[model samples]
Target: MSEPVKVAGLTVRPGEKARSVLTIPNFWADGQSLEIPFMVLHGKKLGKTLYVQVAQHGSEIMGLDALRRLINELDPGKMSGTLIYCLPNPLAFREKSRATMFDPKPGGMNRIWPGDPEGSLTERMAHKIWTELVSHADEVVDLHTASRYCPVWVFYEADGVSEKAPSETARRSEEMARLFGAPVLYVETEAYGGRRTLRASCVDNGVPAIVPELGGHAHFDEEAVNIAYRGVKNIMKDLGIINGDAELPKRQVKLKWRADPKVYVSHCDKGGVFIPTVSLGDTVKEGDEVGFIYSPRSFETLEKVKSPQTGYVFTIRENPVVHPGERLVSVPEIIEWLEN
Candidate 1:
């Protein structure tokens, strides 16, 4: 049997499940102290540890329901590894905002990893989580939600194919991302470019990590919730932490984009009411008309938004009203298509 696992002042023995909260000190005398609540499941047999976190941004709340379902279904007595689930930004989650007033900057939870104890409030919370929760992870998954019209996808950092041999960590991360079973997978080749994101920090520390971006921010996307729940189980199976085969889609789009993938976003050139003709997951070629901007006042077509590359549509604006420079649709540069 495996030994007991200790984290965040809670000790979870083999074949046991437990919950605890790590309290963060409020330096300001009148400020309320922050707390990060987490759950742990320590299995009977010795195996790897998987750490999953959600709601770094309060508005990105689709995964919470998914995680809730996952927790209810998991059984520590029948498993062979450890599972740690945590809410990284409780303050933001409480207010249903992207970032709280105590944070140093907007969306600071996702930006700061391996945080400093003596830093800002957000940084201090991150520090506690990293040292007390994430440091014990053998693999990591950070869940997030995007725009309402965005399609579900997985993102992991990888070096260019020609740059050098891929590290073991990168290879494992790629495998995990594939097993996640998302319809779209993004292999970012440029790395984080100085961003201290949780996923990047874990990868840098020699632990494999991936981020799954569920769709429909601030709302319950039923399909996304189901996908998130299934994806986590799929990864657990792939890691030999569970007993089952990963269920993947019939066809999946794998985009190995170099540098910044956002460069492929089709932005509205004229301020008007934008209408997107292409739906998410639609494949498109360069110069193909995907959307149009109609002047609401003049009742005339201001511009026809054409796709910038031959790829799949993963993000489309749901709001019809638009302004100059607002994104209409994003068709990232495609590298390969996988079929199972």
Candidate 2:
């Protein structure tokens, strides 16, 4: 028998659905308060509860589509555990960044997790959402996209977070990432624990979570959305929240991170007009040609940009213009994870 679930001031029994908007203690520039619109989906049988959220940052929007379509595909009448779906930080979505117009810091919401209840406006909002929503969940799935300048692949936390020893939890996290079916699965540990991202917060709190970084910046790509949609369904199936056989992508490659630079963020050496020759997901070798830099005035080629390592493009600035020492590309290599 499934137990009752409580969140956002609402209690949900098995085999039922409840929808509501959670009001947070924050406001927009116009003084309009912020809220997280959500739905509680309880399945007929007992199983794990998966908490899914999106749009913590303003620019990332595909999460909405994935959640909506996932809802359409998922029938609570036939589900097993419960699924909590919420859109956190509406102010960020309204302004298209993580921080609200009232936020003093321009940095987005991903860096802060389980935030301060009485702290900054954004942290206050984070505190309310975490306390009222994610705290009770058994698992978490956060959807996201790259900035307007580039595309990204799906990723999850790897072993050695906060420089601690690898645990079974990290392996469990990797298993969930594999079920996501994204061609590129980056196993990164650098952005864990202290970062305070929602996923990081959940991982630190004894919950296994994954962040699916779908491509398309500032807009929804039907192709990417479909891929994301399939990924979510696969996750739901894997968690036993919903009934279905999980679909797997062909040749899902794993990218392991060793350190900061090893993750492969390529920066511009000299300021100029940069043009990308490679698209997202294209393979590259160290010193492989990726793009070119040109003079802004006459648009004459000034430098030939090349790949810094042997990997695929995890992210690339779409804008042709570039500045010296600015991050122009990110090429993450495929690496094998060591057994525990």
lDDT by residue (tens digit), candidate 1, 1-340: 8999888889999989999999876645697777789999999988989999999887688888998998888899888999999988877888988888887766557877778899887888889999999999999999988777877889898744323324888888988888888888898877453557888888777888889989755478888888899999998888777789999889888886556544788887789998889988888998899999999899999999999888888788888899898877888878789997
The sequence of per-residue lDDT tens digits that candidate 2 reaches over residues 77-143 is: 7898888888887777878764665664555677767788767777877888788888768878888
Root-mean-square deviation (CA) per prediction: 2.3, 3.4
Q: What's the C-alpha lDDT at position 250 in model 2?
A: 56
State the C-alpha lDDT per candidate: 0.84, 0.75
Give the range of the ten consecutive residues with the poorest summed lDDT in model 1. Answer: 157-166
Give me the runs in candidate 1 sitting further than 4 Å from their true place.
160-166, 257-262
The prediction achieving the highest lDDT against the true structure is 1
Candidate 1's error at 270, in angstroms?
Answer: 1.8
